[model samples]
Target: MDLNTTKSLVTSKTFWGAAVAVAASVAGLAGFTVSAADQITLVDQIDRLIAVAGAGYAIYGRVVANRKIG
Candidate 1:
């Protein structure tokens, strides 16, 4: 799949998987071990947080716009 054509980064499984891997590696470097299941949970939470932030930004943009939606 071409990442360039993807509408949103949060919708990509590969992106989330990589994020989990990076998180695990960072935690390991900090002397904290994160289990596989915990890593999976972290991916889900991060995905949700990003999605929510995007939605919130969209709403804020609309509210602050000078013109009404058609």
Candidate 2:
């Protein structure tokens, strides 16, 4: 994947927002309340984790790649 894809993983708020919304909905249905601040915190933490994992995977791919770009 290209760097833009990795950047998107870090910067795409819509995707994360939708995920959090679904999770919050599920929590609400289960009789658990998720506060706005908590949702924001969850998004921030998940974003950071995704960013780190994406970067690591990119680096690993480069290291293990057997072919060269033209």
Candidate 3:
């Protein structure tokens, strides 16, 4: 709801674990046919995007957690 509450969730292991699970499922589903060609490329790109998003969330959580509440 609020910024602090969201930050707490983002900083928690459960949140990241869920995120990883969702990301992996999406990526795995897309290339489940085992085309093993462009499908690998697609999965790689999807994984990279997910990793970037997770890194961004972690950075944002750190920033928000360090902010002085006024």
Candidate 4:
């Protein structure tokens, strides 16, 4: 696919919607887990999970979008 096609797909509602959904779910889970504890260890774990999930999504989108462009 060409750059135009890739841009079209990346900028589409579906792609954005999915990304947002994934991010939201990760955040929600992290928050829920953290809320159950007052210790720094649990909070750090939740933060780490959220960060990993967020990074994964970002990398995934970048790779997929680049593949489509190429």
lDDT of 3 by residue, 1-70 (tens): 5645554454455555556566666878887433345545655665676679999988888787957658
**Per-candidate RMSD, Å:** 2.8, 5.0, 9.8, 12.0
Per-residue lDDT tens digits of candidate 1, residues 6-58?
A: 46767766799898899899989999999999988877888788889889999
Residue-level lDDT of model 4, residues 1-70, one tens digit each, is: 4745554444345554555556656778788432223344444555566668779999889877845554
What TM-score quantifies how close candidate 3 is to the native fold? Answer: 0.43
List runs of model 1 lying over 4 Å from the truth: 1-5
lDDT of candidate 3 at residue 6, scale 0 to 100: 52
Query: How does residue 46 of candidate 3 score in lDDT?
Result: 59
Whole-model Cα lDDT per candidate?
0.85, 0.85, 0.63, 0.57
Q: How close to the true structure is residue 13 of candidate 1, measured as C-alpha lDDT?
A: 65
TM-score of 4: 0.38
Q: Order candidates by TM-score, high to low.
A: 1, 2, 3, 4
Model 2 sits at a Cα RMSD from the real structure of: 5.0
Residue range 23-66, candidate 2, lDDT tens digits: 99999999999998998999899889888988999999989999
Superior candidate under TM-score, 2 versus 3: 2
Error of 3 at 30 (Å): 16
